[model samples]
Target: MAEPELALDPIFLLGAGRCGSTFQQVRLCETGNVWIWGEHSGVLAGLFRWGGEAANNRQLTKYVYPREPVSSAEEIETLQHDGRGMAWMNGFRRPDLMAAQRALVLELFAKRLPPGKTRWGFKEIRYGPADRVPLNLLRMFPAGRIVHTVRAPFASIESAIVAWELPTVVALVEQNDQAALDALYLKHLDRWNGITGYLLDLQERWPRKVRTSRIEHYEDERRELFAFLSLEAPTGSAGARIFSKADTAGGYPGIARAFAERRERFEARVAANAGRAGYG
Candidate 1:
């Protein structure tokens, strides 16, 4: 069966969790002609990884298909018999595999468009360079654009700990587990560094197809963002409600004391990462 074509080229909003990407998605949807969906929990990333393995299979490339067409039933029988001994006898062609992948993605993300919407896309937080998401996504949708959203590492990490009720944070607050908290903080800091580094590399490779959006500069970057997406800026604060107050009410006494003890080191790490990610 043939797959349906997408109504328009897609947009992928990529960011770490708690990076205001949800707000960016909502704001983009306010354009009335666009529909930006939420995360699918890395399903597409997994699919891409699976496809990548197949695409890179050297044995499949060498043995799956004949260099020339078979001319006789005896030759076909011989090939079939030989194929029966191999593990990947039915390996797929690259183009066919990509088509199948695109069809599945369209079914999941773009099949049922709302009446007035002409474009559709999704926001995901779980993809990083290791997943090769941007690379595979571009192969599937050559015209697609990627928006890499970012927030300050310290604020983003703090927000994620509270909002997600991370175990390390809980232990730090309740059990005074400073070592666990330190490990957790370092893990997230490494993640931020990797994601930001990947984004910068992607931008360098595909400058016209990728853009970075920072939470702190959302208001100032509004016009540029809309323009980049070829969207009309919503007029007169039509989408002004996109911004929500940051959740900063709770006090983490243990965390505070720890930060006081390690403020210089933490600040230096954040500054180094933020600078790499194009933040001031």
Candidate 2:
């Protein structure tokens, strides 16, 4: 009596936090065929650790039902040897078990999306170097398309400081301590560098399935981007709402000067990432 369900072709948007992914998510969802949930990588992470009784056990109901399922910590630990536990224990190596897990997860996504949507996915900012979360997603949904968003390091760092009101940047602004400023800048730079490296690696490893997009050119290239993902491209101002408000603030002129003062030092550290992000 019920209609058959549409198969979800996942479209994952990956990047560091504050790299314009939220905006991309809005645009992609505007296509009307893509149903997306925001930042649920914790669910996938639990699946990764599900079968490993050797590791700390997390209750599946905590992730699956998420409606205050009753179980003490010790009671939850006992589940590692039960049905859901066994589903992932040797499941990763067994084709049938892996398929079951994938089906279950896909069914979970289907419940969240409204009818008539042909595809589903989510945006995750949690993955970086050495993190197995993204890898696990790829394993679960091999048919998924991965879009990595990138932004200029200077803009990302400045926006982060302004948006979060980071203490490091605040201290550097008020106190002109050269050593402290350099240290804080390097910390942000290293993080951006690591994220860029991970994106490069994903692109190389999955050339056909993975693609990089610069936030700067995203508006101009929306047509091609939609084509690559097999979605109807947005036109006019239908999907052009800019979600990130960090750059609208006026303090960047002062931050730019601070960066210029240490340009030589910062440039050397981020040269590769800048090039990869198309920020020459």
Instruction: Please tell me which predicted candidate would have the highest lDDT against the true structure.
Output: 1
In candidate 1, what are the lDDT values of residues 1-280, reduced to their tens digit? 8854566589999987778898888888878779998998888877877777777778766765444444455665567666543444453467667788888888898868777776999999888877978767876787888999998777776666556654556667577777776777777767777787787688879988888888777888878888888788775653454434543314666665664555457777767658867667
TM per prediction:
0.85, 0.74
Candidate 2 residue-wise lDDT at 67:
34
Candidate 2 has a TM-score of 0.74
Q: For this target, which candidate reaches the highest TM-score against the unseen true structure?
A: 1
In model 2, which runs have C-alpha deviations exceeding 4 angstroms?
Answer: 1-6, 41-43, 49-104, 237-243, 252-256
| Candidate 2 lDDT trough over 10 residues, lowest sum | 86-95
lDDT string for model 2 (68-134, tens) is 3334567556666676643433312234445666777777765567666668888887777755656
Off by over 4 Å in 1: 1-5, 65-91, 238-246, 259-263
- Collision count for each candidate, in order: 0, 0
